[model samples]
Target: MQRVMAMRLRLLQRPVRIVAQSNAAFSTKAPEFSDIVYGQDTGVRTVQFNRPEKLNALTLPMAMHLTQRLHKIEANKTVNAVVFSGNGGKAFCAGGDIRALADNGKDPATRHGEDYVADVPKSQALKGQGLGTYLALTGERLKGHEVIGLGLATHYLPTSEYETLVHYLTGLEFADHVPQEQRDEMIHEALEELETDEAFQEIDPEYLETVESVFGALNDNDTMEGIFERLEKLNTEWSQETLATLKKMSPLSLKVTLEQMRQGAVKTCAECFQMEYRMATRMMENPDFFEGVRSVVVDKDRNPKWSKRDITKVTAKEVEAFFKPLDKDQELILYPSATAVTEKEE
Candidate 1:
């Protein structure tokens, strides 16, 4: 525990800058970091991550620094907006370079040992689009026509028109002379004009069939082991690759993700975020997230010795515990303010 706290302190020390709302309103001083730069416009603050050689891979300190800068921005009333950018031309981010462990740890629910999960799908379904929610929660990425078909994207403009769209948005940003509704119309029209018929093309029947057979089966899986066994029976290249991917992930994370996806399908967007916050808190307490980061990203070993190596060893009770309600005071309250729950539900 001392080691964890020491490592955390080491990571919190870094160089970062923020456009102060005012000099008098802040008490915290900027840390000494060379990899980040901050700039300001009339009412905009620009934060540029400056690790071009490392593809702007965010160190733990950088994350802590960015959090501080964000807090300062939040306290200031004068700052109109903030923009994040990367200094490199190659990649925007290479992900975080994390250490072995960062936070708390816990054992399984009731069993006191991580129980190998074997559970059944709930017979009842939600009022919302559960499959869509499940696909997102399980992180089943959709590309090209798949994205449009899954309602994941509203606009599918061509590569050629990207620059044009950016320019139009930038010009409109400075053109406050335009009314808000007119501005909205102009943006919508610009995207529509740049769109291609490629987006409207019918999804392949074979693709739908595969999705039904694969993802559909996954949805009905009782446990991670069941999912793997189901995949192994398919004995195809895609199934093999999929198993490899899942194995690379933290076992505990997989369990949490499974439970969250099932819950989020019927949940409000705010409710989903709240549920995720609980899951994230529990994951931090699980150590597997940090271990996953160390083995997969920082160490490059690609071998994470999870606390529980086997999915069948994971319990349905254990998975559900991660989503249990936190103490009342710690709960996320999205409906407290006027703009609360403002974003559209996915």
Candidate 2:
């Protein structure tokens, strides 16, 4: 893990120049994406996850397709910003498809192996490391307000004003080199439309309180060991509920998730993706992950019989193994441009 982190730091030391290009020569037609809607009007490009029946549960192929589309968007100078939403008005995304992970009937080798797990989480972590760990481990769905409160989303809108927001975005026109304040003003006006809705206002406090309480508890400890220890000692109703929830999850996953979140704080987004690729590959070999998917997704039984029921029994050595690199061919390969710029550099 230290060697990988050192390698990442060395990679960042090298300088690369990015020359801005004009979009006039590029194609205007939106590229087709599987399980996604891609469209552009004026300067705004919108990407909508389109699997309503499954609550927009992202599959491996869907994630890869979306990633490819986003790369294309990055190179297109016509797009000012992107508006991401989900079809069916229920959820933006329900995270990965656990049922697909558990299903080994058609292609057993491809479905349940080091390769399968590495591929899925590698794509997800490239987008955001913290959210990937939380979603992959707990399978907890986030609604509009929760998503916004977590800083994963910039704006929140009620379902009623969804079309209005899209229309407003599509109507917007910007100069080739627009002022930041002008963009902010346009966004402020679009957000103002949702402020008038009583339902949207009502959800705000509840989600904010939820985020505060959970994060406050998490902040009480500096390390994952200390955090879990504090959690075990707490007597409050929320603490008890949280502990019960943790008990239900796979022990291996919980340990891996904690390490993922811990490393995410220090690692670049691209580095975190590489780390997740290694951790997830090892997780697939463990029986608990398959059992977790079987109980929650396949059978809908809500009872997963984990290999190690008690968190304390999950050895530190066991957790450490997940961080080791995979074979050269199996490792995640990140694009140089995907490396994030640190706040200090800005």
Candidate 3:
């Protein structure tokens, strides 16, 4: 626990920079759902996710549709804010569609995916040479600084879901290191903490019901007590209503929220929103995300063949690479008014 907090603090100590790029690719796709709800009230426009059968899982088309819709809404004068939600009430999104990614992984073109991941080691070696050949040639970037930049400024609300998943996966990578006895002890502690956690108390009982619907039956007995105890020690504070609202919100809103959170420091609420959009674009091509879905959702094999293979396989250089700004060719739409700029005047 001390280690996790220490790691988080170390990660947060970095500078934030907002570089404008092109938004040219945002309109490459079109929306396919008429079931999507649109609202321009309260200066906020919302686009809901609406697909619950597959747990609101996102497909490539769905991702493309979301990107394109966000572009349109950002350009519209009537909208000042946007909300994303899901229909059928199962999930906001379990994450990307793993089945699609697994299918894509099988394609001949995806051979590059493996080769490119292989080249990452070479890229790390290139660090000492002062010229990174891998990034220059592959158009790859670093995320450490970006995460550091984002974590310092991104409030829990917008980036919470994605970061929660990242934390879960990150912790999972270290699970083997923990002795069974310690694991059981931590689990017991977390379970006891759950009883006193009152965030659930304020949420609607019906919404609380939905959580059980997705996670499965809750227990009145001691069966799940250890699991609950372990979770409490981890100090995870999540609300079902907030999760429901996120699930029901529009893809456009979600993207924007994610990008803003990823891009800048979370000094203010407005700043976080601006960062969410940028972060989404970065993850659009990230391998961990796709791999995460494959392990947890698609294959059901419970093993994610991460691009890095192991978390330790992810070096400081590679994590640093994720924060690098996109190449000059990648366009970012600059909504000047959309930015949360509070830079002091010289």
Candidate 4:
């Protein structure tokens, strides 16, 4: 319990803000048909991923469409809970389609055609709606009832009862700008009748203890090398499997991920994104990015010939270079100010 909660808390504290606002900005009103589809059920808007054939893998256009719908929903005062589901129940989203990313070759710098929306105003930050559940899907990805143990999902309703639950929730007839407490109580009552009292199958109390025991982010000093060393010391099946998985990933990416986690821990959502944008634009231009996408996606081969195959091959300065701010004109425009967040060099 301690470890899972700790992991979730850490993730919540440092929300990942990688998605940048497209320059063209999506019109809230989407085309009549597209990869992303929308439906209305009472006050609830169901945003269903229509690419079931691709296991709901997101293309760039699909991502842009979904982003626009979300912005429109967030701004709509009449809207209630937004239900996100896959058109085919197999998977919500298998993840992004990186094959297209390889085609991107060098398009990131001018990847500024779409628009993005903002969140609740700063004044409403303290008294905002209570139903905005931030689901924590980390590491290998927790699924189904496992999310409840980590406080990721508010309720655990089975698929059998999903239709009825959605109907009941949407039937809720609250007016615009309802009080936070009242709105929460209404949802609590609706879910109480349907939420299955199913015990978590995978993430038991011991699971959290296991996560805490792992030499990862929970331990402040755990670098990529240190983590591998600690896992070796543990000598458990989990550690061995994790080691294998980490070994397959590009060394430079692993280092950058770890460092960014440390930096993002103290930065605001917007700040974190500004940092990621700089890193992303730079990464797209790197040879490693092309090699990775080619081997993993285009060629369908598991063998990725990374320039820096091992940690010894990647230097601190190389990782540090990714955190530097982009030019003011190229920076992510979250606010009117164009100042970028710079990493403090060691």
Model 3's TM-score against the true structure: 0.32
In the range 30-81, model 2's lDDT, one tens digit per residue, is 4456588876666677788889988998887787667666777766666666
- Provide the clash count, candidate 3: 54
Report the C-alpha lDDT of model 3 over 165-265, residue by residue, as the tens digit. 22222222112345546544432332232222232223345633433333222223211222233334434344333333333323232332222222332
TM of each candidate vs. truth? 0.61, 0.68, 0.32, 0.73
Candidate with the larger TM-score of 2 and 3: 2
Residue 132, candidate 3: Cα error in Å is 33
lDDT of 1 by residue, 290-336 (tens): 67766766787977889887676788788888889877755655434
Instruction: Please give the lDDT score for candidate 1.
Output: 0.55
The stretch of ten residues in a row with the least summed lDDT in candidate 1 is 111-120
**Which residue pairs in candidate 2 collide?**
none
Model 2: which ten-residue window has the lowest total lDDT? 13-22
The root-mean-square deviation over C-alpha atoms between each candidate and the true structure, in angstroms, is 13.8, 12.5, 22.5, 12.5
Estimate every model's Cα lDDT from 0 to 1: 0.55, 0.61, 0.39, 0.60
Which residue runs of candidate 4 sit more than 4 Å off their true CA positions?
A: 1-31, 107-139, 174-180, 199-202, 217-221, 336-346
Task: Tell me, by TM-score, which candidate is best.
Answer: 4
